[model samples]
Target: MPPPILVTGGTGTLGRHVVARLHDAGRDVRVLTRHARPGESGIEFISGDLLSGRGVDAAVAGVETIVHCASSFKGDPEAARNLVRAALRAGRPHLVYISIVGVDRIPMASPIGRTMFGYLASKLATERVVAESGLPWTTLRSTQFHDLILMVARKLARLPVVPAPAGFRFHPVDADDVAARLVEITLRTPAGRVPDIGGPRVYGAADLLRGYLGAARRRRPVVPVPVPGKGARAFHAGANLAPDHAVSGRTWEEFLADQVGDAPAGG
Candidate 1:
C-alpha cells in the first residue's frame, strides 16, 4: 500500500476542503482529529492532538506528506513547535503549513495578538524548525479568509449599528482557493517559502461591511470607529494588503453571495 497524506486540522474550514481535494485526486489521505473514526470511502481519520502528542505517532506513521493547517490562535507558537517535534519523530518527508499574511509587519492588536500574536511569528518559527530538521517543506502565507468577512458581518449585525475599526484594509481570499493552492504545493517539490496568496481586490473594512449588508439584505448603519493601538495602526497602514505578488481569485462579494444563497432563508 502507498503512504497516505496526513492532514492536521482536517475538520477545520480549510482543512476539510484540502482533504476533499486530496481524496478527489485519488491520493490516500489520513486526517488527524480528536476522535478516530472509520475511513470514509477514500479518507482515513486518526484521533490525535498536537499539544499532548496523543496518537500523533500513529497519525503520522506511514504518511509521507503532511499539510499542517491546524492552529490555535491563543497558543500558536507552542502548538506549532509541538507538531514539528512529532513530525520529526514520525519521520515525515514533506510539511506544508498554512499561515496568514502580514504576520511580521502587524503589531499586536488584540489580546490574541499580544499572546499568540501574528501567525507570521509562529509560522516562521515552525518554518525554521522544518527547514533545519532536514525535512522537505513548503510554507504558504495568505491573506484573510473570505469567511472572516461574513463572520464579522454577522457579529456586527447583532448590534443596532455596526461599529468597526476605521481605515482597516483586507485582502480576503476564498478558503477553497487557498486549499487548492496548498494541495498543489504538496504535490510538487517543497519550496521553502512560496509566493504570498491574496484576494483579487483590496477593500477597506467599511466597504467590505457594506457589501456584506447588501448581500444579506440587511439594512444597518455602519459606523467606523478609529481604534487606538498597534493593531489598529497595522490595519490602517494596509499591512494586510498585498503590494506585490497578489494571487488574485474570487472577490469577497462573490464569496458572500454564494454563502448567502446557500444559507437557509431568514438566516
Candidate 2:
C-alpha cells in the first residue's frame, strides 16, 4: 500500500476538514497534533508538537504529501521551521501550506503592528520556509474563515455595544470550501502559490456582526471605531479582500444562519 498523507493541525478549524476530505477519498491520512488523539478508520492520529521537533520526524516518515494547516496567533514560522527540518531528514515530500491572503500586503513592523498584525508576519515567514525548504511546495492564501468571523462576532456581541473596526471588511469563506481546495492541491502536482480563494461576497464589519446577532436572536449596537496603525491602514485599502478570486461558495450569512439559528441570508 502507498504511504499515508500527513496533515499537520488535522484537528483544527481548517485541518480537520482537510483530513475528512482525504479520508472520504479513500486515502489513508496521518494527523500530527500536539495533543494525543484516538485513531479512526483509515485515519491515524500521531501525537507530535510542531512547535518543537518532537515526533515530527516520525510523522513525516513515509509520507509523500503533507498538508500543513496548523497555525497559531504566533510561532507559526517556528512550527514551519521544525516541520521543514524534519521533512528534509525524512525525504522530499509535497508540502502544501495554507496561509492568509494579506500576509504579504500587511506591514507588521511596529508596536501596534506586532500587537495586531504580528500573525501576518509569522505566516509570511512560514511561507518562505516552505518555499525555500528544497522540497516541492504549493501554497494557498485564503481570506478569513467563516468560523473565525463567527467567533469574533459572538465575543463582541457579549458586550452591550460592539465596536466594529472602521474600514475593515472580510470575505469569509467556509472551512469546508478551503479543505476541498487543499485536497485538490494534495492530489495534484505541486503548484506554486495558487490563485487565492475568497468568499462569494464581501461584508463590512458592522454588517457581518449585525448578521450574526440577528441569527443568534440577539441585539447589539455596532459602533464604528477608528483602527490605529499603518498595518490597519493598509488593511483598510482592501488588503484582506479577493474580489477577483471569490470562487468559494458559502456566504457569511449562510454560515451564521447554520451556526446560530434559522435566519435570512440577508441581514
Each prediction's TM-score against the native? Answer: 0.89, 0.97
lDDT of 2 by residue, 66-120 (tens): 9999888778888998999899888989999999998899988789888898778
* lDDT top scorer: 2
Over the full model, what C-alpha lDDT does candidate 2 score relative to the true structure? 0.90
Q: RMSD in angstroms, candidate 1?
A: 3.4
Model 1: per-residue lDDT, tens digit, 141-237?
Answer: 8888988778978899888899877888888888998998999999998898898888788887888877878777788999999777776687778
User: How does residue 178 of candidate 2 score in lDDT?
Assistant: 88
Model 1 poorest ten-residue lDDT run: 258-267
For model 2 the TM-score comes to: 0.97
Best by TM-score: 2
**Which regions in candidate 1 have their CA more than 4 angstroms from the true location?**
109-132, 262-267
Clash pairs (backbone) in predicted model 2: none
